[model samples]
Target: MKYNEIKNYLNGKFVSGMGEKYDVYAPINGEIIGEFKAATKAQLDEVVAKAKAAQESWAGLTAKSRSKVIYKYRELLMKYREELSVVNCEENGKSMEEAYAGVDKAIELTEFACSIPQLISGKTQDVSKGVNCKEERRPLGVVASITPFNFPVMVPHWTVPNAIALGNAIILKPSELTPISAMKMAELWEEAGLPEGIFNVVNGGKEIVEGICDNKDIVAVSFVGSTPVAEIVHKRGSANSKRVLALGGAKNHIVVMPDANKDAGSRDIISSAFGMSGQRCMAVSVMIGVGSIDEVYGEVVAKAKNMVPGVDLPPVISEAAIKKIEDYLDYAQENGAEIVVDGRKVKTDEGYFIGPSIIDWGNSKKMSSEEIFGPVLEIRSANTIAEAAAIQNESPYGNAAAIFTQNGRFVDEAIREFQAGMLGVNIGVPVPREPFSFGGIKDSKFGYGDITGVSSIDFWTNLIKITTKWNPEHKVDWMS
Candidate 1:
């Protein structure tokens, strides 16, 4: 009953997590903030049953009625933005500004979900004389979302609001490390008068994730995590014929052409590469210099060198994350690559902190290939645009790639040639806003469709085609 006691939410009330208890930490100080019992496998059936019961009435409501509830949720999200930001910062190691950005993104997605009444409508057409055909998108029943720790609030909101707004009941299984934001949002939903069982949150680790994937009643799943787990989720979820859209890790690349605005390129690469401490899937970890782009590279290094932890960068997620990044930096050292910034020396006594580190291209496989998932940026130089594009293509991840150039022809060429699902010309972080959609290609994402925006409509719903004839066709035709 105490605040910060993490629990599963069902029927508009806090249902205590009944599985193995896991300690939640405040990443900044590595302090035990709370504990959550992982939802047991035994709880899956009951959870699905509740979701089913709530979804029936929910689906029966007109789209307008659903929009009203979504509007209320959006209002509450905005009202509690500061409170949510605090929790997000405590658990996820994001700076207050970054935490606020996460909450704002969640609110933006909720606003997008509120427009479902208009965006989710079906199409009608006349196929034959005296016959009319139409298609309607129906809810996929009880569904689930497995979000990562990187963007706790925004990622959960990614699938939950959109799926539920379209009439499905959704179960949110947030990462155990950062369940506070989701649990807090669950409370907000209750206050917003969302019907019991319509929105649920099951807090836990991998077991609960497997429980979600294996639960027969859960017809669809949306997951955001590393590549290996994303592939597993997609495969396991698909084996059961479940609809799945799993977003995975990325080693995103940003190209800085010689003609690019030096100041803008410096600012953007630093923001994109080091923002959120480089944990996000859209974070650009690799920067490719096309031709003699030394000015921008030097400027980026100059700007990054002075970045103090807790101001310019959030604390690293955990000691484990710090070690992983350290190991990769060691790889650069072994390969004799110049460490331009040396993030290892930047430290704080109270928390896991790594300052922005820039390394000139190591020419090592792991340096160019693996996703370090920390604030380590690698600078690669290419002789031409084709070489730059090739460098990006060499990576297996096709999540996102950006090019900073003012020339329209180069921008157009980059768009066509870049081997990525999401491409940006001048923008560093190419995360598509609401209505535009966000996703990547190849190992970066699995299954079909983007995770948000209009593309998500298909992932969370089922389409039905209806045909009726008032009278028999006068003549036989292929349509008839």
Candidate 2:
């Protein structure tokens, strides 16, 4: 499957778009690896119409039958894991290991969706005498997923499989920067014998997105992007009377108690801050050291300084990303923060790379609160555990927070008081497995549904209740 052959997958076939084609670049070497045609208005309309028509028969299928098709899709995904990883590495600027991990995560969600039969089961209870009520989940007519560029394949799978398996049609609008992976997944869906129009891929910028939002046929829209864009999507989609799940940005914080092991805590902190070049929403951006600021700071800076930029650490997504990170670096120094490990010294000619950086904000809460989205860690000191917890709770973004301590009481207190939607006791990135929901609170999320697990199923479907009563003797009284 060469990149040049990539086209919009519509109605179970590859269809050429009517608009101009744009070049797709490999982030690693800054070379044009392929090109994709932006879908036109007519093409988009046809795609939606086909999706609506195909969804009727798809929704008519039993859950058991749909699960079989999903199982086959998972099998194809596993068989093509290596090839998919290569594509992910080239376009996403992640290391080979991280690319493989992304594919593996996609596979995990696909496997989870295969259990839709059991997950979508209805419940029956007696509401009153001689009346029984049943609650069942049914798919929305048509749904659209707008994913970000960071985890291209995995994020789409976070929505696609669940929506389709539950009997809804899907229109996937992947990030223009990394649309190749979505095209590849569409090919795999065709190979798995999925019905035509059950899944469609549209590649474009804001026009396609606004079209999906305004289209009356699309019942729901799911989005993952920056907070500003997520808010706009949520507002526009909800204004159109559609269900929307818009997951936004985050500036996650990690707390290190005095009783925590310095070495272990540093390891977790380094991994969370630098992994994926700190582009992930759950990445730890702030470190709140309680009564152990000096010890934890020394340990974390020492380990981070030794990591090589492009070789040991992953590169940032694009040159623009690198410049954005550098701007943050310059701003921190200008604001009187002490630079511990500067990432500017680490440079590479082949790719957009930046080494891990640590900035000591020293009781000032200026740049420590923003989402840097790069491998720059800010250290903030707290006088006591209560103050540290307060600092974590006061942040407008309640995405993820972690507390490291050996004391059982402190761990318990942190778990209870932390305002984040996802909390970690010792783990740095405590994203739960496939069956659990993945999202944040406050400005970190806009809607009720998260991306993966049962939350995904719930988002793609609407609950329907049925109340039934049967009386054999009185059936023909009115007619007679």
Candidate 3:
């Protein structure tokens, strides 16, 4: 299907700015689907100014009123869910099933953000010395978000709607690779009668991004990408004193103990290892298990083999991603890691596809330290549960780690020892609900605030405490 030419969705309209428009190819078969404008610094400045203008009024509205607009947008999203899902799948190269879920999850995020009127309400505290003290959360005026390509819809949903619902005008910089879906979301907001400039979608690379981050009008910047790029953005944005939340790359792990249920662990491993083609920041790229569980490890390999590769999963984000996966596979093999399963030959005419592969990288140095964002996993065998836990702790990335076990003591011990920002006992990916915020630790995530749900409103806005007193008997008017 041919998609429309998407330019900058700026200030209530779509306009082609001064930049090269690149053709978006269908990853499966390398077909040119449509053209998208690469934004320039000028376009970004204009958008941010508009956002700042819009945010003034948006923030003036009550939290309930602002949330109503987001709620209406959520309804419109459901009404056109199928159309959006198709667009997501065709452009993103994910299987139809995964695309459907991504759309659904985005809708859920919008709805969740819409239900936070009470959560954003200011609080009051009783203080002595004849003073009434109160503190209230206020909108940060204008904010910016830079989302990754893996889950274009879901990642931004994790940022934008919450910011808008909490009364902050938002500027979103979606990945040029799959920017159409975000533009579609902008249209839905307009249809929901949202004020112009309250939400703007700018499509571009670094020039536009830096312009937005450095702009004084934009108060905060949220980003998700590789560790190196995230660090750069975080460093630069924070240098200007902008509130920045930059989510970096992760080498998440799933540890298995000898006492763990082998069947269940294998299932969780398969799902977490290959879900979304392992393009998610939360996907388990490494598996640390006790060496005594060799039979269970074999079971994991056999499960990976049964996965139909290209037919069952979406392709990696780009051709470069495919090359990275291939290079890592070869590199791991060359470094003495045993390839228990190889999905390199998987074929799909429509997208860049790779199936599922498992590598026993126990003997290979640095194999367990890398984050391969594809349908590949490295299994590291440890002599004991302590060794497995140590392997999980030694990784530089502490975004998330999962342990599978039935023992309460083991679960509690692992919980206390794992250095990850997020942990899952039996679950694979423990991305939290709207009430709980999502973030990572170490090099995985930057900044001091959470990006979504209630914390989003908290992060997008600052707090001010107010104190007042009225006493007629002791009225000493000091410019009262």
The segments of candidate 1 whose C-alpha lies over 4 angstroms from its true place after superposition are 1-4, 362-366, 472-480
Task: State, as a TM-score between 0 and 1, how close model 3 is to the true structure.
Answer: 0.95
Candidate 1 backbone collisions, by pair: none
TM-score of 1: 0.97
Q: Estimate, for each residue in 26-77, the C-alpha lDDT of model 1 and write its tens digit.
A: 7788788888788777776687888898899999998889888899999999
Lowest-lDDT window of 10 residues in candidate 2? 471-480
Q: Estimate each model's TM-score.
A: 0.97, 0.96, 0.95
| Deviating ranges (above 4 Å) for candidate 3 | 347-350, 472-480
Clashes of each: 0, 0, 5
Where does candidate 3 clash, by residue pair? Answer: 27-351, 28-350, 28-351, 29-350, 309-355
Per-residue lDDT value at 135 in model 1: 91
What digit string (tens of lDDT, one per residue) describes model 2 on residues 205-319?
A: 8888898989999999999999989999999999999999999999888999887888888899999999998999999999988875567678889899899977778778888
Write the residue-wise lDDT of candidate 3 on 331-371 in tens digits: 88888888888878664555688778888877445674677
lDDT of candidates 1 onward, in order: 0.87, 0.88, 0.82
Error of 2 at 204 (Å): 0.6
lDDT value, candidate 1, whole model: 0.87
Choose the strongest candidate by TM-score: 1
